[model samples]
Target chain A: MISDSIANAPVPAAAPNPKDFAKKKRTNRSAKLKQCKLDARREQWLSQVKNKGSKDESNGFRDSSMHERDGSDRSLENLEMRQRGEENDGSIHHDSDLESPSNSPTSNASSVLGGNHSGTNYTGSSSSSSSSVGCCSGCITEEEEDDGCLDDWEAVADALAADDKQQNPSSDSSPDHEPVARSDSLPELTNRVDSVVQVSKPECAVMVPRAQVNGQAWRPDDAFRPQSLPNLSKQYSFPMNSDRHYGRGAVSWAHKSVISAPSSCPICYEDLDITDSSFLPCLCGFRLCLFCHKRILEDDGRCPGCRKPYDLEPVEGEASLNGGSLTFRLARSCSMITRS
Target chain B: MVDFARVQKELQECNRDVEVSGIKVSPKADKLTHLIGTIPGPLGTPYEGGTFEIDIQLPDGYPFEPPRMQFSTKVWHPNISSQSGAICLDILKDQWSPALTLKTALLSVQALLSAPQPDDPQDAVVAQQYLREYQTFVSTARYWTEAFAKTSSLGVEEKVQKLVEMGFPEALVRSTLEVVGGDENLALEKLCTV
Candidate 1:
């Protein structure tokens, strides 16, 4: 497009002074030629990157291996499955860290209470000794064993299915249960293989609670249900936790789409965390996130991304979502949770 | 970037007359843009046979604000003060308009040098000399123009010495001179107000 515009521009006639004419011609020709070459190189690089795979990979989500797989003959779904396995391993390690013996304050309290009830005001002296032997070593090994059990994908799937059934018992007997049943019946698809292939369906549900309790939100039922994984995939077509790899076709397309898309956070190179992000709308259909919007507003109440004036009217409910009106919402509950 | 299209159009019209007349005006920028203007000092004056250089600075709000002009070369006249090289002219102040171009402003400054408005004196002493000792003032103005403002190599210290000799106190004169930014008469008036 740029090359066509340059080619279509009319050339000027010769000047009276040959020396001045020569200088002007040299400057104009070099500048236009340099610009054309740069644009061509950019277009070529973009096409090469785009041909590699799904657009999400370029948007800073795919890992190095997934990128290499996309570049090779391997399918995007298979590459996603392998990436999910790696992510599950990481989650397991995180779970173990949280569930370690050193972290079990409840067990230690129970041991102290048991000693106090036994009339051994000797509870004080025995508490220290019992805690070291009966709790520390024993609990550590028991916790390690529990962690090992969680490493199995089948067990994790069963646990999830069980939890789902417990929470939505009515749905278990309904026709809507077929999707869940179908998902569970295929144990081979346990490693998020189906989810990866059926990527367009928004499987991940995020229900941001609107109220706060003592500065922390009451823990939601699905708080631990792997929210980041699906959210990242929807936005970039790759795992959220993976270190970015720039090579894949999908990754490049995602990057171009994002870089070209107006609302993307310049700092994180991710879509603005929509739940918490504020919006500044312009006539150009460019919506800047709160951070970028604020910076530009300070200079002039104009959209930095599009260089157009913005009108910041308060939008109510879901009506604001229409016509690309930027909406702001709190992502996480801000209620305080106190265990009795 | 600057609106190069507008700048190019303006430059073309500006250079047309100068190019035809075999005179040259080159646009250059250092601390500020200085339009180095060369014109044969008009005939029949004491300043005849001497070339003069005028320095002009366009303020940031150009077109809206007037360009500041001062004679880089020294000259003496009833209107051109030898003390601070100040030219008593209305176009440099209230008469300025955005529509006025650099070439026109420079031409006006040249015309002011040829026709001195000594009655509205910036340098009262120079005006007095022009009234009382007309030939002496003209001779001194011509001598200074030949010695100072005529050449790029003329030291600023020599110019300062000539201004001091014109009855301007060294300190008040320096402060006033600096205040007007090398315009001697305005600097003296500003100093006097303090």
Candidate 2:
């Protein structure tokens, strides 16, 4: 029926403004360019890691005794080769790609290369190239130190921060809000060049802007203002109960004593209606009503209240039918009341 | 709730009468929301005179993912499995995007039926037969269409049995002849195998 309805529907006339359409096209193009640059950087970093293994193999004679010391040495070499090959070719082989080798030397390569490439691309100038080369040389000098590895992460983060600074020179005052600032900077950075190119096609020229506006002072709070526009809460409309009033009533006591009064269903966000409520036993004094309890039990049989394993006990009595009218009351516990 | 507004808009843009191998196809719907489609077999193939019927089902995640499609009218093709009507096509899997509509997917399916990809196949026997004996495969597929997929009074199991006498598997021959419930040829293929 829906398909038939769709089949018979009339085509709507095109009435969109040409200017607005052009603006949207431009914005999309810039976003796509930035994405392409990021993808290229990721590929280059992977290639560097692959090159690292080849370099290691060439130096194998110098470290001949080191290879025979551990049985895992051969497997490690194999893994490095596999990682390199998979990176060069986009297709994944087996499940090894999913493993996160966080402490591996390859991880360091990723952070260093990722940071440098993202930094250079973000700053829109070739001046950072000399500094990036210096950073790479510094990585080799400090390769033996654990602190050097930590510095690698910091360097990458700093490079990204520097790029963000170049993009949004007016808002760089606070270091605490750097992450939020970086997120906001992406859209603004893309918006500047959006009108210049057609982004859907991959062959467009990528023009990286040079950082001439670095002298402007930036504060982190300013970054938060633009970034807050796309917050998740603003996107989805949540129903708020305005009519219900919270009070210490008989129903409240029943909820607290029997049905766990303040309990909320995780899925539907409805209060557990007492008549239809089901009790789930747990180590903590918490219980979830029937609907939520059943769904979790079917999934993994883990307690939603504390995430602990529960011993299944048969529930008794008539199924609760509080309907959908009930509202959850949030109240301070007896201990908190006593402390006050 | 499902976004009926967007779904309706997509459905309207889809063109149902797709022509492949000179066969015109139009999907018919039963009162119960199930879909049945008929396509005249193309000339020069073993299925030349056959009117093939297929079933179509729109899963909850339609357009975002490929709709389950299967051939209800059985035919012999290297790419199409004998036991299951599963087709190996890129658009049905990784190449699928939400931008594609039901009509496009079906049109692609019709093209697949006309030109079987024997290299990568769901049924190894069919693929092998297609590779080893190209003429025989074509003749068998055409025979299947005339015997099983004919909408005329002459269309019957006896006619299909005549083709089986020429050395086609009975199960493959029969299931291929039956009309599908939804466009889920893949699921029906698996179902027939079981």
Q: What is candidate 1's CAPRI-style docking category based on DockQ?
A: incorrect
Candidate 1 residue runs with Cα over 4 Å from true position = A1-340, B1-8, B19-23, B30-32, B149-194
Per-model CA lDDT versus the true structure? 0.40, 0.38
| Per-residue alpha-carbon lDDT of candidate 2 for residues A88-198, written as tens digits (9 for 90 to 100) | 211111111222212222332332243244332222111111111112222222223222222122223223333432422222123212222232333322321221111
lDDT of 1 by residue, A1-340 (tens): 1211111111011011222322333343234335434544454345435435422221111111111111111111122232332233233233433555443333333323332343222212122222121122222323433233222222222222234334222221232222222333232232123222211111110001101111332234433233434443355555442223322333444444434454445322236765323332444434445544444444344443444445454332223454334322221222222321
- Model 2, C-alpha of A135: deviation from truth (Å): 87
C-alpha displacement of A12 in model 1, angstroms? Answer: 74
List, residue by residue over B54-98, the lDDT tens digit for candidate 2. 565555544334556667666677666565566667877756644
Q: What does candidate 1's lDDT look like per residue over B19-130, in tens digits?
A: 5542345555433344555555777777776677666665654433456666655667667666555666776776654335566666776777677777898778878988
TM-score of each: 0.28, 0.28
TM-score (second chain) of model 2 = 0.64
